[model samples]
Target: MTDPDRERPAEADDEQPVDAEAFYEALDARGRPVVTAAEVAAALDRPAGVVDDALSGLESDGDVGRLDVRAAKTAWYAPGRADADERITVFEKRRDVIVDQPAQYTRALLTQFAHLENTNREGGYVYTVREEDVWNAPYATFPELVSTVRSALGGRYEAIEEWIEGQWERAHKFRLATHEDGYVVLEAKSADLLGNVAEPRLDDGVLRARMGDETAWVAEDRTAELKRTLYEAGYPVQDDRELETGDDLPFDLDLDLRPYQADWIARFADSGSGVLVGPPGSGKTVAALGVMADVEGETLVLVPSRELAGQWHEEILERTTLSPEQVGEYHGGAKEIRPVTIATYRIAGMDRHRSLFDSRKWGLIVFDEVHHIPSPVHRRSASLQTKHRLGLTATPVRETEDQEEIYTLVGPPIGTDWEALFEAGYVAEPEVEIRCLPWASPAHREEYAASDGHGRRQAAATNPAKIREISAILHENRGSKAIVFVEYIDQGDAIAEALSVPFISGETPHARRSRLFDRFRRGAVDTIVVSRVGDEGIDLPDAEVAIAASGLGGSRRQGAQRAGRTMRPVGKARMYVLATRGTEEEDFARNRTKHLAARGVRVRETEPVAVVDPEDASATPDGGGVGFEAER
Candidate 1:
């Protein structure tokens, strides 16, 4: 509100006091205190430039603050107050917390039992406590969690605190432990619940014998099913087994961990298990090595594919003092059971391979891409009884909405705020733009409308016009390391053919895949087109750009994983998601980008840059119009 003619803030400026009160009110009415500056400007019915000036004044006066605004056009802002004011603002009805001007320690304390939603530019953070957060809170006793909640809130929130206590107690009702005779045992905190809730809920095949009213002998083979069933029944089984600490294999990490990595290791050590939910390039692999060093015992690392297994094997050798003889790879190609072994989930879950892994008293078991822990084959790997368990993932999201199973099977989510990591220069936050394209031509639109179900979906996903847009993007970002992701191999092949790049798919032989990926990493090729295999298996940290030409069936985790491919320690990274306008791809694109948007990533819908019709004989396409250009 300061006059442009004034050298400084004007006197009698009480009226020009940034009008922060109105902005806050507008933001509150929008049901989220955090918003882009553009959003608040629209809500206030004021000129965006005027709103920007007022908000900037408010920020100067410490009344308003920005969240971690990224390189894109998105500028996040929220209300702030004096440091002496209550840092934690609880919304009882919504069960969310808005912490203003919170210190690093306060944020760390809150993460023990609250899910950090977003971080404000004022160094404040937003967090929400869910049932899973309470259940997985790294506390041996309820009092510890309560103390943390109260300390972070700066006082008791009676209604929410009581609700949290109830959730914590529910998690304690059932526990899975090792019986003295070397079998898995299920115990209930009370007799009635065991007899009434657990016993009847589990079949005879699951519970072999009733040791007592509150205890039962569980079939080792059915342990995974038992844990999953009780969890679905609202009584999650706690794994408190006296499992093996494996043979001693001591080593030290050659890498110095970042502060956040150290904090993660500290928390994981206290719990003896946890999932490291960090963005890609946040040193999760190195942190895992630190964990292995802390455990000082043989470890088993489970990955979804052989590429990741090999990556893990190489990382373990390079980061730790472990030698090649000390480490081994167990998969279809090779089967070795050394002290430190990396195995695919399928190999680890097999009956024969399961025995081999079971026989080794692994002090630690790390599940890379732990999001896969909930699948049928991967869930079998969760049955292992070990002293320490760790899961790692950039996106702990699943379309099935069963991501909580990952927490139950492995451990709680332990992560630094992604925004914090970005701010600290540990990981670069990628700019994401959703490019919606029109149909390739009248013929293409007609074919899409004429078809049904899968045919229609295929038409939208493989729109020929998208290839033109991709060409324009690559042309603009030339000399950048890029990966074009596709869901279908046929589409990938076509794009590869058009782009003159190698296409890597599941059908690509291991040696060929390895050679292409190596070439990409070595900068021999600036770009490559890949299929779904690149979603999780590809770990190229130097990728500067990711163009999701065709996303899979609207998987939120897949979208996040693709964006994570470019999260690096330096330089700007960008993600372009292409979808056919006026088709199911619109909804699919939204669903795909939802996770990254929720995590404070800037996800904007833009019209693709001018795409020409290949069938046209002229310079422009038929019925040509200027294309939508994403904000640079």
Candidate 2:
């Protein structure tokens, strides 16, 4: 049976003709020649109307690509590369063919992509495109390719079937050669294509598609109904099964589950969908897996970073009985499909060129670092029709303009309070001590005030004199293994240079960073001056002290995460924040206090500052814990 979607319309008598050879020759002649209608007519030795009509027809057929020319009636045509790419052609053929035979292809793509997204929020799946493939070539030639195809078919071919069977044979061959690299290309037309191929079944007013051996569920076509129901229902808890730990297992995974993690699973099981906002070391990852285990669908995890993807891969390996084959990692650099997949945000979101929509139907999508969903690409993931969506983040709130989009698109926050988590012992609580640094010399103060917010914070945080005081305090009081965190990379470099300690940043390579983290973990490195790398994901449990030199104003999540580095319940933890007195630094420090308070972390100001011992001590300002010796 010829599906209506696969049917080509009858050729129009007034439709344009294809000048395939002429178009190809014209594209090949110039080193970036701007072809105007007059130029095309001259080249083809045809009338201007013929040239214009032919070019328009080619553009419509996706053979020739058209770009607008400013203040001109003529549109420029480039080759449409997708038309020539065998991978796309084959996909087009197979997509339609499979609908008639094995309808599961559509379902498989949707399911898998959806599941992978659920895994982590910030990471992207890489579909490895071999350098040898023609499809991976530059985007400039795509319009030209399309134009060539259209011109070759000419105006005589009016029906889609006739074009596909006759003149499009070459195009079909290109599609056959180009493979998906395990990453599915989700186009705007894909949803409609799927709807047409698989007869949609109406179940309890919900939309269901049955394709070959598989049946998949889609969000009901309620238009405004779902939102209305949600508003009226007020987040009713659905009956879902919670998985018991160590009760049923397909594989032997090594890891201890905290009771709070069990409760996280239970909550997800109870409510079905919500965001898991926790501070660092709160074990959000493990809890997410448990939720996946409890849910009926295969788990799809998405993360923000490649390192996090690797981390999840290692953890998933430990937990699932699925072999390496079953667990696929779809990132930007590599593209292979798997039943249970782990991917990055770049793969699922903005990296649309790779066409991620080709994956299977996702039962659940886990967004690690939920705050990222506010990003333009990530926000779109929330609107995707998935069975369950879980967003995981250490700090979920960022004052981005797209917060409303996040709420509507990615499910609303489940209301997991950071303080509540600490009180419940899901996360550890730390004692926060505020240290006031003395005003810098007049010259230094002028320089600081002259700089931007970031610079001012740095000048205050890394004053050479303050480092020595911190050194003394660390030697006398904090852990042997301590992390001195600064807001700026330069400040980190300065402190590390001064203290003769190692440090890492976003620019740090994976191996070197891993080695540094290991050394810190093993206590081989006593003090590490890390910038923002310490904020999320990396586990530094043994460290008992966190010295925050500078940070955001009223960023409760940042404060909680920084403090949580030492609050791992291994022992009593102390978080010392050095704030320069009588500046925005003081105000920024105070503003963040409220959010941290939610985590049950209170910052107590120590009284009566002690000056560095020396002849200068008598004259020096008594800056409490804040006054540290210079970077010496």
Which candidate leads in lDDT?
1
Model 1 scores worst on lDDT over the 10 consecutive residues at 67-76
Candidate 1, residue 142: the lDDT equals 80
Q: Candidate 2: which stretches are off by over 4 Å?
A: 1-256, 352-354, 401-407, 412-426, 449-458, 607-632
CA shift at 241, candidate 1, in angstroms?
1.6
TM-score of candidate 1 to 2 decimals:
0.77
Misplaced by over 4 Å in model 1 are: 1-130, 136-161, 177-187, 205-221, 611-632
Task: List, in order, the clash count of every candidate structure.
Answer: 3, 86
lDDT of 1 by residue, 146-210 (tens): 86676566568899888998998898898888988888898988899988898788877898888
